[model samples]
Target: MSVNEIDEQGLGPQARRSEATKRALLDAALADMEATGEASIRITKILQESGVTNGSLYHHFGSREGLVQAAIAERFLGSVTKGLAVFAHRVGEVGSTEQLFEVFRDELVRIGSPDVQTQRIHRMTALAAALPRADLLERIIADQGRYFDGAADSLARLQEHGFIRFDVDVRAFAAWFLGLSLSRLLSDIDPQLNPDNEWSEYTFRALVAILTPAPSAH
Candidate 1:
């Protein structure tokens, strides 16, 4: 009867079908929102587009609002996770701080510009503001910490290579940069904001400017 109930039954053919239906519905919702810039979407439209039945929709997502929130979460976090994975792979291969940041900046620009992602960021901001449960807040904080850990590794590598000033605090720098980037993503995601004037480029340049490098011997 409930989404959780469906999930609890384990992965059977029907379960997989249900999961796929949910994915399709969410994908449809995102595509529709991006095309029309509409904030409110109907579950019936999503079901119709996804080619899923009403019962399947109900089994997959508790309600339209919950589906919207889940879709938002999936798109935003999925992009972020993909970007971080790329950065991690690059760093692991070359062990170069410069290379890591290069990949990171490019990925951020791509992720931050998309309409679906921007919408998700806006949703996340609203959810965080209104949600008062301590456990929910704790999970949000923990998720943030995990995300920061990936960036912190690259900063630490920069410090190790003497690309950054020794006095610089890696965790603090990572936190500050991450916060700034996420804020930018939130702003760009808002449908009302017209941020088409090289915002990401400027942000990347600012980051490179502030990251003080050590003096090299002549």
Candidate 2:
């Protein structure tokens, strides 16, 4: 596949789906979690669904919990990478920090799959549980940061072009932009407070108006 095609898909074809056995296991775990919720997920069920051996699971993921962590981490980063693909695609289109906000908004919409609500819950749960698991924390955070940095690179370009006004730190803007999109977890806290349409419209306009023109000099 073309480079963009690979990236647009998920973490590149190699990491995403190249490992037939490991991917099968991860996919089975995700499917199981989605169908019955994490409470009902069982290792036997995952093994049976994936047709991967116990030894293979242990070798690849270390244990049942390890498999679960890997599954959640992969799913979470997959959503992130999907959104980054959009920003990467639109890198040339950005003309302002406001446009970068539109990119952030678009990234959220891109990641907002029908199951995004479920995925958000799963992501939050995994992170909470990961607090005690250093290995899993490293994997999840590293994967997530990798993509955010990729998006930040795009913002840096816009700043160079005078679209994103000077003096506005691109890294700060990038991180804030990502956090706002990743706020699905917070949004899910209360239905009444989680109006996507109103929130989206407001952020788009707010972001544009927040920009100040570059200073002129004689």
Candidate 3:
């Protein structure tokens, strides 16, 4: 069978052996995709690198496209969960809302690019757009909404504590910050470009300038 014609469809594992193989293949795919962005991955390369037979892959992923989508979702969703958890914990830690916002902003700046956090956003958004009718696509939108809500909640907490500007809509600001961060993340997908040159303290300062108000104004 041609590498391109691998069977696509079926997560069911009737036996332990089947389950193990499936787990290995999926794990391999997730690792590969995370190392080399989803935009430029190939099933053939995956199989070659993963050392799994086409049938093994097919039994797990069903098709090349399905495998890619699953990998993308697995890799990105896992990252999103962790990111939210960190933000949530940090928000709860501070004695006041203002400190929470400051810490959050500092954390955002502290997170180095390629901003896998934002890369997941762009990756999944593009994937869902390409396949709008898919059930998974709807789930992706829901996931993004939750992500936005998380950001908004953090912002709201900050606003409540008098950190973020009360006059500004926290949700809107959160959305804008999310969008901008994702944009910058996707734009810097290639590492050949200088990572430090385009994004650094200056970039974060600009982002803070927009999302936050001056201390004097507060």
Candidate 4:
């Protein structure tokens, strides 16, 4: 069932109120983290910003660490999910391999842009934070699974339309594409290694070579 459906059918009024309080705390925590560039947020500050009680914070999230982790998962993974969904939609709309490659080239340029690179760095930072915590890591893994599955489905559709190579494993290709996008983080940190155009051109060429189907053997 959908989250809204579950909220409406499974939760009582008090539970819904509690969920709202939890959301408020998460939003406050995420905002503070973003503003301060700190992963660990002060509980008192979060309580003040959220207008929720300390007791409510512990009751909802168990601890300040729990609250921060939840906030990271909510914001970072949620952003990735939304991004993948949009890309999947774009992939579905293309009528030919050239159009697909055009969309991908556009995505490469867009992601390599300064603003999006900052977002990508934030995602990597969030991922690092999640790595030590088992629960958070599991959440990240689950979200990534969804991302891969969604992208693979889109690629499979394109393959059916003869846009992608028949021999390619759509799931593996999806993972590779995501890895390529995230690889920009290496350049993001270095001042002397700005190869935006060269990187995009190389990546686009690699994708074209990998995705293009071979001629029929007569």
lDDT of 1 by residue, 72-136 (tens): 55554565566567666665554454765676576565556565365446445534532654544
Q: After best superposition, candidate 1 residue 61: deviation in angstroms?
A: 1.9
- Per-model TM-score on C-alpha atoms: 0.62, 0.76, 0.61, 0.88
Instruction: Give the runs in model 2 whose Cα sits over 4 Å from its true position.
Output: 1-18, 95-119, 209-212, 215-218
Highest lDDT: give the candidate number: 4
lDDT of each: 0.64, 0.72, 0.63, 0.83
Q: Rank candidates by lDDT, best first.
A: 4, 2, 1, 3
| C-alpha RMSD in Å of predicted model 3 compared with the true structure | 8.6
**Predicted structure 3, TM vs. truth:** 0.61
TM-score of 1: 0.62
Worst 10 residues of 2 by lDDT: 206-215
Residue 115 error, candidate 3, Å: 7.8
User: For candidate 4, what is the lDDT?
Assistant: 0.83
Which clashing pairs does model 2 show? none
Instruction: Pick the TM-score winner.
Output: 4
**Candidate 4 residue lDDT tens string, 1-218:** 34664554598667778888998998888888787555458888888999999998998889888888888888668768767877988998999988999899778877877777767876887888889889999998888878999999989998998888999999988889888888878866778776576778888999999999887687
Which whole-number lDDT from 0 to 100 does residue 175 have in model 1? 70
